[model samples]
Target: MKKFKCGVCANTVYFENFRCLNCGHALGFHPGRLEMAALAPGRDKRLREARRGPSSPMVYCANEAHGVCNWIVTSHPDSGFCDACVLNRTIPNLADPQNVRAWGDFERAKKRLIYSLLRFGLPLDGAPAGKGPLTFDFINDAVTGHLDGVITIAVGEADSVERERQRQAMDETYRSLLGHLRHESGHYYWMLLIEDTGRIDEFRHLFGDEREDYGAALERHHVQGPPPDWSLRHVSAYASSHPWEDWAETWAHYLHMVDAIDTSVAHRIEPRSTRFFSGTARAIRGQDAYRSNSFSTLIERWVPLTLALNDINRSMGHSDFYPFVIPEIAVAKLGFVHRLIRESTT
Candidate 1:
């Protein structure tokens, strides 16, 4: 979510930009460096870099041919997709124009999730022998969207109308393509790091025992909804359904908060408090979120940003961008996620 610019003209650009808006130079993401590079012609169809350190020979991922990916392969000499794209088990049908657009949105959101995970040095093993990697299935079918080892994203979820309808039906404050990807991936990582590893006891103590009957719990949740005082612990109403849901929902919000601070850092969006310790708001700076070990700095940045954004949204007669509150219990859960991710990096 950091700011990107063209290496050729220094013009502001977005992560999804294929070519510089001002310079018209082709662009590709260098995953190794965690930066974007402007592209120049090279041998065959290969390209020579122009940014993010010295210019080097590189080629776009094969998915670029279909306009779905912007990442480049950094190691292999032969042309291929980047490490993130290689996990693709099933992509949407590209022949249809609407499917192609929906697939593009899905890829963009997926890449954002992968990018953040990689920035934290999380392991992303390649697609396994036959089963698949932490793969994705962007399907247009009757199957419910979920993750049972492989992440599934319904193509209709990409449509703004359909997404909004579903969000309203579920009475969620926030929902998006990125949110779905992050939440589902949370389930995948929970099994990988918590269940398979030895963090089960700690996880259970914080999020509750996952041994709870998921089907019945969910059934009760949908029928009765979350308790009125659910915010005292769970991040969302859906999170109150079960221990597994609590972990995934909390994990997704952790991603949301961190990513938001990252963008705030990249843009130098810092908020300063005027009063001393007697005041309510905490002081926060853009750089603190990325550098500080404690969640205090990140939460300090998050609270004010949410406040400002929510007020601005009201001016435009729209719903709050982040309508949820983070009480002490939710903060404790987020701190656990923070420690786990940082520990993995070390």
Candidate 2:
């Protein structure tokens, strides 16, 4: 996530900032401009343009009434929810106080994921006949998260303590609401970009055979554990369970690296040009990750960024923020994601 600033006060703010601390101005994220703007109150606390120009007034999404979102609807006032929230197929019954709080927690991570997706300029139109449109369902579930036509997230994942416990129970080095959303969405996109398009053969070549028996493979994985030295290529041990899983896991990791690297770029946290961290570091310099034609350079820069952040995380006595490595083969898979995303958008 890139750091945001309050346009009114020129003070550091956040994407989820509800009010500017210094200026005490109301804040809302404008998706069209991809900015967090300080609102000048209009009639009845409605938002006036913070930008110094002729402008039309804006209002927060309907979900803001519940304090569940802070995104502004830049379109018609009757649009109700922002683009992101509209994809929600089912939300927990907010009548229960626990469900209300859990739903709030879920929205924060969901918005962040959507922000990254929009910035990448990928497809967000969703699907017709329940086949294409990406939707999410937050409810009571036995699973942490799962994706079919809709992604279902267990409300318990909203609690950090509970989520961490689940992570440890599953032996995951990293897991979070955002991670769950990104990972599951990978499956949805796979259905759209690969399965529906008849490109599974190419996908199989890169990841492995998705046609392999998934349930039996998962049984073997849990019984015997990941192949020794799974990290040599797979993004996570769970990825070794099946090809479909590997693709989803890799796709999730791809989003993770890019988002962090995008943050580095936003904060101007580039490496010293005089010193190259690795052989490809020089090759990666100056590429706009959001618009770059090549994912090769993107991954090259992401490696050093991930390492630096991981070291910093250790210094703070926290686990590595990003706990996986992209070996040569893994990079090849990520490159396929890059090309696939480009293909989808264009």
Candidate 3:
């Protein structure tokens, strides 16, 4: 996420902030401009940018009533919900306080995912040649997965303890709401960019043939864990189960890498020069991972930075921030994702 400041006082604010801490000005994220705008009351329950005055009438997304969204939309006839909230097809019951909180967590993570999609210039609505717009279902007692164009997430995933329990039960190294969303959305985009675009041959070459029976592959994976040399070929153990999964896992990691790099750069966090790991760490200052066409540059900066981060986490008695390693094969897959995204934008 990019660093934001209070337009009123220039004090630092965050993406989730609804009010500036320093100046007490109301803040709302303008999705179209992709910036946090200081808000002021306008006519008829509308808001205007504090800096721009009444000319810019805006209204908070309808989800604001539930205290889950802080995005704003123009006060036009058809603009009630923001771009992100409009994708919701179903939200967990809000009558229960716990469900509300879980939904909040899901929305927060989903917004971050949406932010990355916007940054990459990907079609949020699955436009142009897509089968339909992408939608989301935040439900309970359901498995998290993507089908057709809708992505369903089990609300329990938002509970840290429950998520961790699931992770351990599944023998996974890492798991989170954002990770689930990113991984599933990868499936949605696979339909659009790979299947719809007639690039299945290329995808098969990189990620094996998708013609393999997914159910049988998953059953076999459950019966027998990933091969001992899985790390040499796949990003995660589960990824080795199927070609589609491989694509999703690699795509999720790609999003993770780019987002982490972007956040580090925005916060001016750079890896310090040290002989402990080899030569000087790559300079990430002013680097924009989303706009860059070079996948190698991302890997170069990501490796050293993750090393420094893992060391910091170790010093604090925490596990590695990034637990997975990107083998050469995974790098090629990531590069393919990068190319697909870049080509789509053009």
Candidate 4:
């Protein structure tokens, strides 16, 4: 979330701006350079020459053709779509008009997710044969009308008003597009982790035996609520529904910790002391390599900062910004998550 400028007029811009409110310059995200570019067709014919740099070859998101996003592609990638655009398995129905607005929100949030993945050096690949590239399908029910097995994201999740209503109804503190990305990534990573012998047993022990029947577990969770003491074990009430959900929840939390700590460090918030687990907050303030660095160093910064931020959110009449408690067991699980990310990158 670094500051950006309008390449056309030099005015500052946001990551989501399509046209410079100041100069009306068409904008695109260049992933290779990790910067936004302003384009003035018929005005700035020298754009290609202006920004031809060695480190990051620049391009633009193809979705800009549809007028949905204005992010520039920083890399001269083999693929036309940027990292965020590539993950869209299903987009909303734009013909409905309202969906056009929803698509915009989805794109912004998806970009934020891409930012984190790129920052962390996660992999993004096309789906296997028959699955197609990690492509998105922005369509109405008619496109998937006959499919029973396919999961369709109700475009409504893209709507802020609708999403906020759902969040309130569910009594949750933090809900955002980035959160959804982290959660969904949990499912994606399952394919990677379940194959590993070293990590499989520990994951099973904490998340419940994945061997248990998933459909049956869902049915049971529906008919009978999670045990009243579910919080003592699971991070969220919904997580108690199944081991798969538990994994997703934990994965999302891991992203949360990593990103939060990274931002804190970027802002230069120093830790009070360097005791075990006391550095989480301080490390974030200046630690550029939050993931590869030791978790013990991070705990010092994270624990205190999480507490202070939570209190600030409550002061504003909101629920605690983070609702889950990180007990010793969860801490161990987070360590596993860190290891998994390290293993994946290596």
Best by lDDT: 3
lDDT of 1 by residue, 203-262 (tens): 988999899898999999999999898989988999999988888888899888888878
Better of 1 and 3 by lDDT: 3
**TM-score per model over all chains:** 0.91, 0.90, 0.95, 0.78
Ranking by TM-score: 3, 1, 2, 4
**Model 4 residue 324 distance off true place after TM-score fit, in angstroms:** 2.5
Instruction: State the displacement of the C-alpha of residue 192, model 3, in Å, after optimal TM-score superposition.
Output: 1.0
What are the lDDT scores of the predictions, listed in order?
Answer: 0.81, 0.81, 0.88, 0.64
Ranking by lDDT: 3, 2, 1, 4
Query: Model 4 residue 236 lDDT?
Result: 70
- The predicted structure with the larger lDDT, 3 or 4, is 3
Which residue pairs clash in candidate 2? 126-133, 127-132, 127-133
Better of 2 and 3 by TM-score: 3
Find the candidate with the highest TM-score and give its number. Answer: 3
Tens-place lDDT per residue, model 3, 113-178, is 998998899997766774778899999999999999899999999999999999999999899999
Off by over 4 Å in 2: 75-79, 128-130, 272-286
lDDT of 2 by residue, 244-295 (tens): 8899898998888788777788788855322234433242355567677877
Better of 1 and 2 by TM-score: 1
